[model samples]
Target chain A: MTQSHLAPEVMARARDIVALYPHPRSALIPLCHLAQEQDGWLRPEAMAEIAELVGITPAEVLGTASFYDMLHTEEVGTYVVTLCTNIACMLRGAYELLHHAEESLGIRTGSTTADGVFTLEDAECLADCGRAPCLQVNHRFFGDVSPEGFDKIVDDLRAGRLADEVPHHGTLVRTERDGGLRVEAETITAERRATAAAMAERAATAAAASEAKANG
Target chain B: MTVTDAPKIVTSRLGYDDSHTLERYLATGGYEGLRKALSMTPEDVAKEVDAVSLLGRGGAGFPAGRKWSMLRKAPTSYLVVNGDESEPATFKDHLLIERDPHQLVEGVVIACYALQVTTAFIYIRGEFALGLERVTAAVNDAYGHGAIGRDIFGSGFSIDIVVHPGAGAYICGEETALLESLEGKRGFPRIKPPYFPAAIGLYGEPTVVNNVETLSNLPWVLSNGSAAFTALGEGRSTGTRLFALAGHVKNPGVYEVEMVKTTFRDLIYAPVLGGGIPGGRELKAFIPGGASAPWFGPDQVELPLGQDEVGAAGSMLGSGSVVVMDDSTCVVRAAWRITRFFWRESCGQCTPCREGSGWLEKILRRIEDGEGRESDLELLMDISDNLAPGVSWPPQQTTICVLGSSIPSSIASAIRMFRDEFLLHIKDGSCPQGPAPHG
Candidate 1:
């Protein structure tokens, strides 16, 4: 690897996530988020470390990371403010909220502020539809937000009033657990081998079935 | 006549302020369902769920009992609870995950007992910060309660539930797509043919993927016999369904009312419910279900909120999200916004969804921006027809998953119900109502 981006402790936590699943690859997305949480975006170094941790290629990691809106490959602000302008939110003054936020932030959607503290995006449905016109700051949701409400939250955020709750952009969940589901390392390795064999067998079965269909 | 609203089954634990806490959950007979399910054999428990006819709440309305039964015959290895509720105006699962996480945990536990699965994962939307926290805590609390993990409740059914966070993809809300995301891949849905989760699923083993709301219902179903659950809502809809009412409603919120028996009118107009539209506005149209469902005009307000009844009405109550739009609302603008949502969230794997969604959104944008040609109307429909061929109700899909099929609903519903609005936009070179819908 070019460099070790994750610290010893951070690497342990990443390993903890890997242990939670029967297959280590299942930890890939979570680790991607964790890497972003550490660096605000997925760095090549972090992605390389993750690939090493999960036994996947860096290119493979990028393929997965690029697919999600939240996992960014490039730079992002410390706080990502995504205003929902989808159906429910749009009908509930989301555009107005967006207009106001744009004016207040002095930056358009999809651009970060001069301070690099905030990045604004006009997002899709954030699942806070009952309280329409929702926006998420660093994945923390704020629903039923008016222009004034959005402005107020921004001020609070800038003033560091809401810093404790509104963390840096990728820290969605911070709940520490006693432990995760852990099976022995050898058991997981064996299971992976078995799963690979099963997959190959299924592929053979499908090939034979297709061949039979063609012959018939 | 609409039947009187039934007692809440799934949302029974919702009203209490501390309802999310494990203490509150235990005090309010939280793990009773897990206890009750443990008392019965796995087969018996599965039978009880089957007797209730509990359809999946995460759209598709597949019977939960049937899903488990299918997995029961196979060597099912995992139970993944879908908590990824990202549909516009759909927050029932979010509410369940955030407000009564312990109840959800209890439900997941009961599901494990019935399915006899060892490891279950709760894949919650990553956007839900509080929900992730609560569910994470709730899962841990369940383990402490002996509801999950090692020899749960001394019933000899040990299970582990991991709450996995989704990084932000609406397509991941789809079942197989969810599996792909859980497996740490892109949220592209697996092409269907040998396409049954009961056959091949997570890690190439049989897996039962159920919704959070569907699993949350199990605690209630286990405690109050399946007969009691079945006796509530009519036909296929056999319980109080959580309807998240949004848009122009005065009191927009998630209300649990008897399915099929309750009308959209009651949910949106009743004083105890939506309390009618805000600003004394006259209702123009409403999306009967989620944003994907073809909308219902005011004339269809009396349509029952049931799987069959709504399905018969050309739009399935797909995600239990009812969005009302009033007379002052610009249908063109609203349709554009909905189109934009689909376009932005198309996952970019399928050509029709990837290219078609962007094409549809651009057309809507130009129309809304007053740069419309009358031909644009036909173009929208043509493209919609291309993606969802025939543009018929119970849409035909050309893409891997339903997201491509879903793009046509808003466009078709607007044109079918409000052609004049589109014509007005074209004739006036702008939306006659207003360019800005609510802002």
Candidate 2:
């Protein structure tokens, strides 16, 4: 049964995510990603729906959700601007950009704007040290960002002029799969299965031979 | 010596036009290593790698071949590439993932074959959207080319790779914690002795966890033979390493240098690398590794860049992230920012790390803000000692992961090396550098 909070397509995708791992519990993180992908944030009902789908309790889902910095459990703005103020970025004038951001938005870090447009956060390290003083608008990077560049980005997003610039929070990347490599248990062919068995035998023999050689 | 003088094995094809594409990868005679590896027995492949002494580039510098051999030759073995390059001022893995993803893919596939890992995962960090996109595209391309997935190149061996994107946790950079995060839980590091990823990991099955850069070296090592690879570097610490330069450097980027053959001084001063610190400012201190490593003064700049040499010089070559600070930069402020990063990123699984990092951040902040107490320095050391007992080298008696140990590494080192500046902060009851906080 599809939950009211989750789209049918999203629920199906969640099931597919669960199938990615050997155990359903292993799908918890990905399923949360799916939930956030659909709703932009993990609401209480959304978490409950995901927990039920993954055969876990809502509390367990929340516990996992709260642990990750990305999987927000509350409401946020359409555009989440995360500025890296960690050691590397801090060295490269990231704090100045942060103060600039705070001034431009008229909102401090960790708070959303009154217009419900932007949510600014002071992130630790986005790990883009090569291009220091970086920021991410809805999880996509704006590398080597300047105060003026950040302002233009904000203005563009506000005006919806930068339509394709920033992806939503949970949209990690755009990938087109031609449907190669069927790894699921249901898709293992008979020939492939026989080959897998032979490979295991070969591995054992090869390992034993190597160990003998080492000992000698 | 310049970074160009070092053999560039891992990043050889880094800037080639359309390098991320499989077609371009093939034009440069890529996947020949996978083909060569496929011709040999898995054990023989592992043996060759062991002969090369390919060290793990993911901070710990563990032997990659030894790690592969340690895996139980089972069909259930899993290969998880730790693409979570979350350490502050470190982005070498980011360079690999974004620029030459197929190198990582080819290397990972070869590793899976040798270690008998049928399924693999590349846990890219959340912020790296382009990396995620590029790696995902590369994996898909690998599948399309029959490089990975069922009966690889008609060898009758089958394996599949999946790109798993992590949702931002620095602690997940630790191997066990990475596995925990991969298994869809909080990024809490599993206690060792009872839990190592190789023997028992990922659903209590045999798993091999390697760094992106470490795996990316396999194709080169396998193709070129072990001797050719090992000839480039000093004893045991074989092969070239990617050193990321940042903070007051003229050219702040990733550079490949031979292990131990290159010195920190050369890395910073060579015109081809860091280019002698930006703005002609005198170098005061630098963290040879990422933020977690102990900071060293200018007197020790000649220390070798190898893991052993740096360790002997009372610092680590951890992750090979060299963050330089000029004389104009305040040590107390730098220490506070670094400590604050550890504080914010602590997973809170271990009490010492969780509480101790917070305490360190608060104390350092107070000291930097000119609210220093005379007793606070001693208290900071005491807390660091509690987190990493004795404040010794190769930090010990901490949490499930070395993150607890990492918390005190820079803090204790900063207090020891720049005690005078910290004392000045206390004596003056404010930042001694000037009105500006960062300077």
Candidate 3:
């Protein structure tokens, strides 16, 4: 394996990441992160370089990189749409959302679109189960997404409207109030609250029922 | 009424009407464990833990007290609480961390005080943002109350608790891999021997890595003494285990019980446990441990649920996460989903695990999708056999880590218990259980 294809900046970042760990070989993960951040995907030569930088054999680096689901080893589209398909999300139409995405994009899960603009992959629980049927475009989350809503977002992205980057928690809406900046409190609509409460209640009921059956 | 017996090990003081709150914890004598531990000699504390024979809650089941004893020789020791809780079907640690953060915090303090460590880290899963916040708040409260950080309780014992969030990697749940991530790197678990965390761990200092539930048991052990803790369970495996029950159960959550006291039938038929399968359906099979263990079908002896019994049955009581499968579940499909999970999360460190997991996943997926080859079933078995224990990989040919062996154990168990089900998937071109979504 060759180790000379990496950009100087990428190498510098990898070196910095490697320095963060006491053992250089332990830096393989962070170095891969830097490689992904710079090149958008882990190339063969880059992986080899990471192995050399981390003081491990190329095969060892490849082995570590391939075990995790999140690390992208191959080339991906400009934007990656990762859908959460864990149990919590599965109950909330995540399957339907995934199917809708596959249909709309004309690409299967783990495959990039023909245009090379989007790649769809199924992810484990994204911890946003409170708002299920969620998808992430480049690390930004779009929660409580319906099929139509997802299609609209994809269409917007296709038309070049960059998805707004927001924090996972806290409010997204900001407003100016009398010469000062004010962040809008998240409004819990009656309908949304009712739906959320109902979901919680259903989960509790299911849990109780499961416990009862187990004990009985 | 006078009760003279020793208290239970894990749940001796836990589970009294939603007593997860800090106030309730204090009222029920929670932090007293830490106080009691702080007054004891570190060596004596380690001995007591060793004598009790408590094991790791994270699938491996290594003796906890022995692991702590191994860390005693390191000059600057650190205690790491493995809060990753990433195993697919396991949720006990999540409950312990989310519902009882202070108890875990108290345990950390006790462990640190015993080991004479100055710092502790909680490497929580990135998906557990809420859990992270809860634990971080609890740690802050402990610091505020002078229970943690510089000179805790004026005993000259200082410890700092740092919450390191993992970037959603299942493999990092392994201790060495967690240390890598804590050092601001990607989370790849290291092969043992030369890289065991105890000796050459975390910047080359002695480190003690324990599961969240294992550490949570520390306070009780400290307060009640080793004899009391050991009295709860059968020989060797002492204490209560928090079984995270799920799938086809009337109730699916964390339940604390004595290690060997509960039976498989008791957990299944008991209305408060698993509700005897769903809709009066017969229990077809169950993953006695987490996703990594082998499946036990109805034909298998319905024995007591414990480490010894489960191990004797050729599976482990891993993480105490019992995932039940009813008659409605197709074993082949279950195996496929589980193989897919391993393939997706293999960490790709070894060829047998990385390539073999992918192969198993592909074969199982094809079989599930009605694209079966007659030889694929045998091929699946072959691949699994290659990854099984005693099998070696290239460079050494022997398997590197438990991650490599876990999937094979599961696949073999699935095959042995449900061979007919696998054959049905290949012959009928569809699951006999039909097209229902698995929970």
Q: Specify the highest-DockQ model's number.
A: 1
> What tens-digit string does per-residue lDDT give for candidate 3 at B171-249?
7888887877776455667766764577877866888889999988888888888887887778767777877766666
Clashing pairs in 1: none
Ranking by TM-score: 1, 2, 3
Candidate 3 per-residue C-alpha lDDT over A1-216 given as tens digits, one digit per residue, 9 for 90 to 100: 544677876677556545433468755654665566667777787788887897777887777676555457788887778887754355456777898899899988989988788889888655444356677776566777999999888888877676444221111112101111112345446667889999999999999999999999
Stretches of candidate 2 off by over 4 Å are A1-3, A176-180, A183-216, B1-4, B73-75, B433-439
Better of 1 and 3 by lDDT: 1
Q: Return the TM-score for candidate 2, rounded to 2 decimals.
A: 0.92
Interface RMSD of each: 2.0, 2.3, 9.2
- Candidate 1, residues A98-200: lDDT per residue as tens digits? 9899889999888999889999988878888877888889888888898888889998998999998899977768886553444678999999999999999
The 10 consecutive residues of candidate 1 chain B with the worst lDDT sum are: B430-439
DockQ of 3: 0.05
Candidate 3's docking class is: incorrect
TM-score of each: 0.93, 0.92, 0.72
Task: Please write out the lDDT profile of model 2 over residues B338-367, one tens digit for every residue.
Answer: 888888888887899889898898888888
Q: Which stretches of candidate 3 lie over 4 Å from their true place?
A: A1-121, A125-216, B1-24, B389-397, B432-439
The DockQ-based CAPRI class assigned to model 1 is acceptable
Instruction: Please tell me which model should have the higher DockQ, number 1 or number 3.
Output: 1
